[model samples]
Target: MRAQEMWKVSDGTGITVAVIDSGVKDVPGLEGRVLPGVSFMEPPVDHPDQKYPPHDDFDGHGTTMTAAIVGDGSAGGPQGLAPGAKVLPIRTSIGTPMAFAVGGEAAKGVRYAADHGAKIVNLSIGDWYSMDKIRSAVEYAQSKGVLVFVAMGNEGEGNNAANPWAMLPGVLGVGAVDENGDPLPSSSHGQDTDLSQMGGKVLVRCKKNSDWCVQDGGTSVATALASASAALVWSAHPDWTANQVARVLIQTAGAPRDGVKRNDYVGYGIARPSQVLLNHAGDPGAPDVDPLAAPAPAKTPTPGAEQTLEPRAESAAAAGLSWQWPTLGAVVAVCLGLGITVMIKRRRRRR
Candidate 1:
């Protein structure tokens, strides 16, 4: 990707980016790039509970996005835009009900990521969360200078975008466009949309050793790409705040299409980092100003929230995998593979 080429001068070595979503797997491309993360699932407490760690990739969605954002170049997969960046994969929800409990788990996940020292947080998955909970956690991250990125929505259905959490006044909201530069059927339009798309009909690992390359259309993938873009810029300039960086991004957005300028369908335009790298775009205006944080009025809920989650017929549990750890009790359950369990070992309280 051009983003990688532009990152020659900068390395995301010290940048920690947390991916909060379905779960990330231990792909060959990301052996040591990912870190152990938390899971807030409600278990039987005393049962054979999976230690509930993050980065399991039950749906496989998180894995693909993880590769795009932080995968190191080992396998044939494209190297991440921020290859040196550390990915802190966390899980807020999974299964058919990815947005389980109205995003309670998600809010907690963001806080946990920030508390653990993630300079950039990527929410490739989105759902309605408690206003107070999400805003508070996000604000806390911002106060500490954390940059958060989110997907607008998978479908045209407009919802979570209006919320202050995923589509907060100050956070970055990402949208998707096909490789041909046309809007995808699934990308949410209006109000929540952000900019750019990479890898719609892209190759993503299905099971641990398998692969799937379909026209994956959704703001989720776009969100991760945008987050990775920010990571590239922020890693280059560690002194910039969330607002300053965001301002630069919006100000430096590239190549606008005819008949559109800053509309919700495509906020500003497709974000091209090359502009800033090449010095074609001027300085990104006021560093402390947040233009996207317009006085957004309160909004309502999405239709999907009213509907129950539809099972994709594929789950990590059916894959026959078990969670592993260096110790006896720190591993968490993994959810990915061809009905074959791949034990993922995680550790806490480092020895």
Candidate 2:
């Protein structure tokens, strides 16, 4: 989304997005923008001997995501898509560790965010595990009129299957694209992916030094950008429900493919919130109807399969990953020309 076009209409004021991740620190660009929230990862659980405070960023991931959503460009920092929006920071993990299962805390975070006046929740975190409880939380948030955005994991090296959260029907699974608008190789693809946005070489605040910033790449970053764009659209049309906001986003998104509904690679094309903001180019459809709801039951891939990027068993999920990015100074190093890398983390249990 073009920051210039979006600023001409709305700056995401009066919108509160719940960011469920590591945690958020009070950096210069987001001094007052981050609201106090909860921390699910604590001592004797996910980690030992340390308590993750509500406002502390353990691995700097949450701070980066918070900047993407509502950074004000203060102290010479990069501007976020919704500089005027507020972020509700909630911690669910500590960097790449799988200390506590993501299913339980994730569900609690969603409900807590929705109950605490968060109109949109940004989940820029995921693993290979599938949990039914997570799906129920997504559905509950939708029913309560809150939009949830999840990142398709960065496991493109092996033609990886979609993460269970990304494959959920009610949640909006987001993919990453380079500045030139090509799909990022690490972005996972699947039927549940709803939109694509900036996820590579993105500039965000650093947790080590509040005044400094860093360059990072991942679907985790992409999810925050997409959620920030949603903030812009939702902030502009405050009267619109969750369904209307989602519908308009799908309709106005850029990149048209043969299929109007979904694209395995880019997921209904790149998100252009400006089109919905300035051009009034999207239809908000039925307020009560969920555009992402799955159709009648049909044969589907088995939920559990070999978690690899190579051609998998026919019973495995049919999602693949690809790469591309231009104009970003710090691209993910994993994108070697015609080469692939495999990154894996073990979850306690498979779906």
Tell how far residue 277 is off in model 2, in angstroms: 1.1
Deviation in Å, model 2, residue 236 alpha carbon: 1.1
Could you estimate the TM-score for every candidate? Answer: 0.75, 0.78
What lDDT score is found at residue 22 in candidate 1? Answer: 65
- Candidate 1 C-alpha lDDT tens digits along 1-351: 354346665546678888776677676878888888777754543654655567565566667677777766565564566677888887755443324442566678788888999988887654432545666677777666787776766545433122223345446667665555555556665554555544255556555436644446366666666777677677777877766667667777643444334555556655655556546463655556565655232232331111111121111000111101111111121111101211211111001
| lDDT value, residue 40 of candidate 1 | 71
How does each model score on lDDT?
A: 0.56, 0.65
Error of 2 at 243 (Å): 0.7
Q: Which candidate is the best by lDDT?
A: 2
Query: Which pairs, if any, clash in model 2?
Result: 158-309, 158-310, 159-309, 185-322, 185-323
Candidate 1 regions with alpha-carbon error over 4 angstroms:
44-48, 96-99, 157-165, 207-210, 280-282, 294-351
Clashes of each: 11, 5
lDDT of 2 at 283: 91
